[model samples]
Target: MAQLGSDLDATRAWSKARWRSELRAARRGVPASVRFAEAMALSNQLTSGRIVRPGQTLCGYVPVGSEPGSAQMLDDVADFGVRVLLPVVAGRGPLDWAWYAGPDSLRPGPYGLLEPIGERLSTTALRIADLVLVPALGVDRTGVRLGQGAGHYDQSLPLTAPGTPLVAVIRDQELVPELPAEPHDVRVTAVITPHRGLIRFD
Candidate 1:
């Protein structure tokens, strides 16, 4: 188990480095507007089947640093009556979340991440969320997720209810056949991609 943990961390670090380089290259190659549009479409399709309904909390990510344009995706989801909650880097232990009222509610924070400018809404408060869209650099068809090596999402995912759906957001090509996984590495139930839409592992 120790060996597996060490190996997973090592592979995670390597994968993160490679993904950063690849993302930079992809940005240079792909049109910014096109990527944004495709991503928006993918997100919309993913949430379409699920009934967000008014008052349902949807845990989401803030589009900061190298994370994808999920901030915009949250906005669209919010418009659909889902109360969006964005993660705040509260500490190194696990991810804490805050309510995202709008663009004005966010402020730049550590590592360029944006968080709630006002009092943070405790992640525990949003425990009844119907859905949660996780941010990931890559994910495999079998639900193996590759995060940014910080393990924030990995640590926070397990806190959700036994059957809460965790969906990873990645590019179409980022969904691979397999990726290095650790016992602690949380796998998302489904993946949302620009061209492919929602892909369920089961």
Candidate 2:
């Protein structure tokens, strides 16, 4: 157990350092115009394909800073009858979630990601979630995910049921063949890209 704990700490540190570098490169001001176009096209395809269901609690990310995907995807999730929830980064632990009513209820928060204007809820509330759209820096075919190095999602994801369908959202190019993995590094079951709505692994 001690060895596992130490490995998780080391992985967290490495992931965080890589995120700083990636964020700087992304924020250097070259627009994600191509990525945006691809993302929009992908969103439309997913909607048309009916890959999601209604009344299912779906955890989504606030697209800001270096994240990919369009606001259209977020809006569509709500419109499609899915109960959307956004991440509420409260501390160094697992991520908490709150109801995502709309963009109106979002306010700027840490790391440029939007937060709920109202109260945050407990992690147990996310137990009802059927799908979680994980934010990733990279993903591998074996279902391993590379996150922003913050153990937020890593901690939060396992709290869901074993087959809750975790999906990593990223650019197609970001989906590589392999990534450094650790015991606490949560693995995504599917990879969602601008070109691919959902790529199933296991």
Candidate 3:
């Protein structure tokens, strides 16, 4: 029985790895112009919608590489008088955060990410956020998020208070029917796509 469980775990890991590779490649295949346009549309959806309220502190990420949204979304959110916090990865542990002042405050960091160049906040700072915009390769109807393999958000999400709105940002087509779930995986509360805006999970 133990051997069976070990084998199953290995198989799931392999499956997740395969999915990550395929999804990342698909995102990369998109033309830069199209990605930019879609990102702008997504920014409009978020800023125009009621998902984020003024004066609310939002935990958001700076999109790197082929990630769906752009850093402009964070700026747009901040422009609404909302406080934006972005992640700062120090090592392999839970992600620390810092205030997103603007595009000028960002500096290149490890793993091709742009981190805030400000005072570092503890992981528990996530509890202060009214909403969190998480990056994802895909998300299913059940709120099961397919994240980058490094598990950065996975480690940090547990710090948020229960009932805090965790929304995954992905391309519309990346919202799929199902995904393999693991015991340690944290479910998202909603998903936001350029075309779909905000979608809630039951």
Candidate 4:
């Protein structure tokens, strides 16, 4: 039984790795102009929709490369008087949080990410967020998210208060019917795309 479990774990890891590589390559193939436009549309949806409210402590991220949305989303959310918290990658452990002051408040971090510049908030800080906009390569109707294989968000998501909305940010095409899911995989509550806006699973 233990050997079978170990084999299953290896298979899942291999499947996840393939999905990450394929999705990332597809994202990178997108035109920059299209990406920008889609990002703007997504931002509009987030702001116009009731997903995030004013004065809410929302946790968001700065998109890198062809990832859906843009830094503008973070700024736009902040403009709504929402206190935005961006992730700060600390080694391979759970992510640390920090307030997003503005674009100027960000500095380049490891893994080609833009992290917030401020005192590191405890991992428990995620519990204070009214909503979380998580970065993902793909998400299924079942709310299974395909991250970049870093497990950063996976490690941090458990810290959020129960029932807190964890929204996955991905492109419209990336919203598929299914993806490989493991016990440790954190399912998203909703998915946001340029075309679909926000689709809630539960």
What is the C-alpha local distance difference test score of each model? 0.71, 0.73, 0.86, 0.85
lDDT of 2 by residue, 1-202 (tens): 1121124454344454564455346433437787678668656754663556876788888777557776667787788788888889878888888998887998887777888776778886668888888888777678888776768888898899768888888776666555567787878899888776678996
Candidate 1's TM-score: 0.81
TM-score, per-candidate, Cα-based = 0.81, 0.83, 0.91, 0.91
- The total number of steric clashes, by the backbone 3 Å criterion, in model 1 comes to 0
Q: In order, what is each prediction's RMSD in angstroms?
A: 5.8, 6.8, 5.8, 6.1
Model 2 clashes, total count: 0
lDDT of 3 by residue, 52-169 (tens): 8888899999998999988888888889888999999969988999999889999999999999999998888999999999989988789999898788899999999888999999
Residue 32, candidate 2: alpha-carbon lDDT: 72
Clashing pairs in 2: none
Counted clashes in each candidate structure: 0, 0, 0, 0
Model 4 lDDT per residue over 1-202, tens place: 1121124454344466676776777788889899989989998888884788887899999999888888988888888778999999988989999999998999999889999999989888999999999999888778999898888899999999999999999888887666789899999999989998889995
Q: Which one wins by TM-score: 2 or 3?
A: 3
Residue 81, candidate 2: C-alpha displacement in angstroms: 1.7
lDDT of 4: 0.85
Clashes in model 4: which pairs?
none
